[model samples]
Target: MIKKIKKLKKIRLHREGTDTLVYGFIVIAAIALLLWRFIDSKVPFWCFTAIMGTVYCIVINFFRCPIRFFPEEDTTGLVVAPADGRVVVIEEVDEDVYFHERRIMVSIFMSLFNVHANWFPVDGKVKTVAHHDGNFHKAWLPKASEENEHADVVITTPEGTDILCRQIAGAVARRIVTYAKQGEDCYIDEHLGFIKFGSRVDVYLPLGTEICIKMGQLTTGNGTIIAKLK
Candidate 1:
């Protein structure tokens, strides 16, 4: 039991290698500014310290990685939340890219304060992964899902149901990192990707599937059950 708990608690740094480079540059620049302020004494020490401190706090929080536990029983029909955010959209829409049919689109808009780590919504094998280059529109906008830069990952369950999840880049979010590879088997609640800064994620479910969440509701990634497959 102890070992099982330990394994569940294991955490991973999403985009750690890239993040390290960013952190190193930010810290070094801040320190250099502080040193310069100290030597010159032209600007008030407190003001400089406060400004740099706030910047570091926000940057650190943006890259935070939290542990997520999977459901204890089999997750065949369970659809978990893929990202931490508030439900922004819940409607039936025509999905042209992958499905070429109508699907129920559930979108979660993430703020800077929310965890940016993404998780797989169900147990499945990745069918395809595609990335698009586009404008940086605000993620909460309905058009962002189709217009903004994003990555789409389609997963097929053992029962042969197709689920499509997309990671979208917001005005402040410039990067979308996806870990999904075609033909790779993925588990529910497992790490899927990360979006730098604030963004959103869209999940396309087949019509007639039970929707468990409502509009404007907040969701905790991997912890909140979004829906159930038929």
Candidate 2:
């Protein structure tokens, strides 16, 4: 019960951001101290301090990794969202790179303020994890799905359904971290990876899969159902 209660907390700092937050705080503190000692004008010191403090607050918010899980006990045939953001796309596209056929693509675009941590979208065994080096495009654009640097994790469900989860780097994002390993089992509650800064996640479902989300709708990672596999 105690663990569950803690998991239900509103906010928690992710370990991935520990170094960043600690270093940011130190750097900001040093700058503020320098200003206070060297500058005679109190107004400029306070103004600089206030601005930098707010900027660090925004960075803290960006690194937040809220504990989340699908509320239901049964997860069979259900595909949960992998990241928190707005559903920027829901369309059927030809996925030539992996599937070599048509698939339904559902994309969630995370802004700098959203949690950068990613979660496994399904309960399955990871088929493979692939990372591609490419240009960083704006994540919301369609071309970003292919042109942007991304990490792909493919999982085969217990029922033998294959799903592709891709994490795309955005214009501001430089790193894509993927934790899912080949042949490893993954669950909806387990984190798949973390993307630094702004980015997006794309889930490719097999043709005929029923999508539960709509374009422009906000989705909570590990909580919102992305689709129902047939």
Candidate 3:
């Protein structure tokens, strides 16, 4: 049981955006230089530079991974939000792929402005880690949960409850990076994975779990308590 581990409050840029940031800056700089050096009008150069600069800053914000910790001491029956986003769904549905039973599915849809880093939602041992290739759909849609390219990570909590966290790819999201490994113990505050660009994360829990979030509510990954298990 991971009772009370270390806490880090500082926010840092995620390394996954390193290459993209570097290349984006270079290309933007090159274009700005050409506009300044070859074009006579200063208006176009300044306008283009400003627009690209704002876009780059937005991209940087997308990759910002904050070091957050679950504040409570006891983790039993606690389930945290796996990603920072607005809750798009909260309902009971039949989970066919794994549980095959009726379960509460809470889905969070991350937009381009939200953080893309994901965190483990509970103290548990990973039961399974699998990725499926599928179509890229708009993440907020219900069908995107299973139809989109995604990674499934099922963790068995210390209390013997199995929790499934699915990372689904949005139409703009092309990559899904999962860090959970089967049979390995995972705890809250540890990164579960990162989704490049915008995406969605769905957490499937057994029916009767007390949900702490409502639809359209904003959630902070690793910080927002999503539910309480039985």
Candidate 4:
């Protein structure tokens, strides 16, 4: 019974848009079958039905829905990675837009196949939530971190630590979702929002914080510790 429950949970994850290729193939196959049946048979009624069904499946699978989650656990001091992707950059940079100071910037680049969920990196009260309208460059491009359409979330921990997380839209990703708003109490590893399709997540940590992961490392949402405040 225990093993069965675990299997069920795994099935749920796979069904929730995580296996995008499998779902895409299924949709394409259904559309092909419908087209063959109606267009070849000269069934006018079936042709209309098939066209609608094909369009519905394409829209629903591509943009209407996405899979997101956050592990329910106490995550304080430790910085949780906000998205599943490869760590592209981890360096000290001057943040002029929001924090107005130097910080350790950790950027994760998500491909089309990655889980797009974004999670809070620390338990804190949201201090600010800002969205900027900008260009949609390739997500992995270095300049995309600052110039791309994105949403910024700043959280102030009980200990007075300031943590910042950003959801950046790529050339293929046009939507950025953020659930954390100013003054809301956000727990670490809690579900904050999501980014549709390929994108990137940038986490800015205050100076003096020790980073746990290195450049080129792969991280999962709420599972990989990006850093810890000293």
The per-residue C-alpha lDDT of model 2 at residue 107 equals 97
Model 4 lowest lDDT segment of ten? 1-10
Question: What tens digits encode model 3's per-residue C-alpha lDDT throughout 34-144?
Answer: 999999999999999899999999999999989987888887899999999999999999998888999999999999999999999989899999999999989999899
Q: Rank the candidates by TM-score, best first.
A: 3, 2, 1, 4
Q: How many residue pairs clash in each candidate?
A: 0, 0, 0, 0
Candidate 4 colliding pairs, count:
0
How accurate locally is residue 214 in candidate 3, as Cα lDDT from 0 to 100? 92
Q: Which candidate number has the best lDDT?
A: 3
lDDT tens per residue, model 2, 29-49: 998899899989888789988
Candidate 4 ranges with C-alpha deviation above 4 Å: 1-30, 38-74
Q: Quantify all predictions' global Cα lDDT against the true fold.
A: 0.86, 0.91, 0.94, 0.77
Residue-level lDDT tens digits of model 1 in 89-195: 99999999889999999999999988799999988899999999999999999999999999999999878999999999999999888999998888875779999
Q: Give candidate 3's whole-model lDDT.
A: 0.94
TM-score of 3: 0.97
Those runs of model 2 whose alpha carbons end farther than 4 Å from true positions after fitting are: 1-10
Candidate 2, residue 126: the lDDT equals 97
CA shift at 95, candidate 2, in angstroms? Answer: 1.1
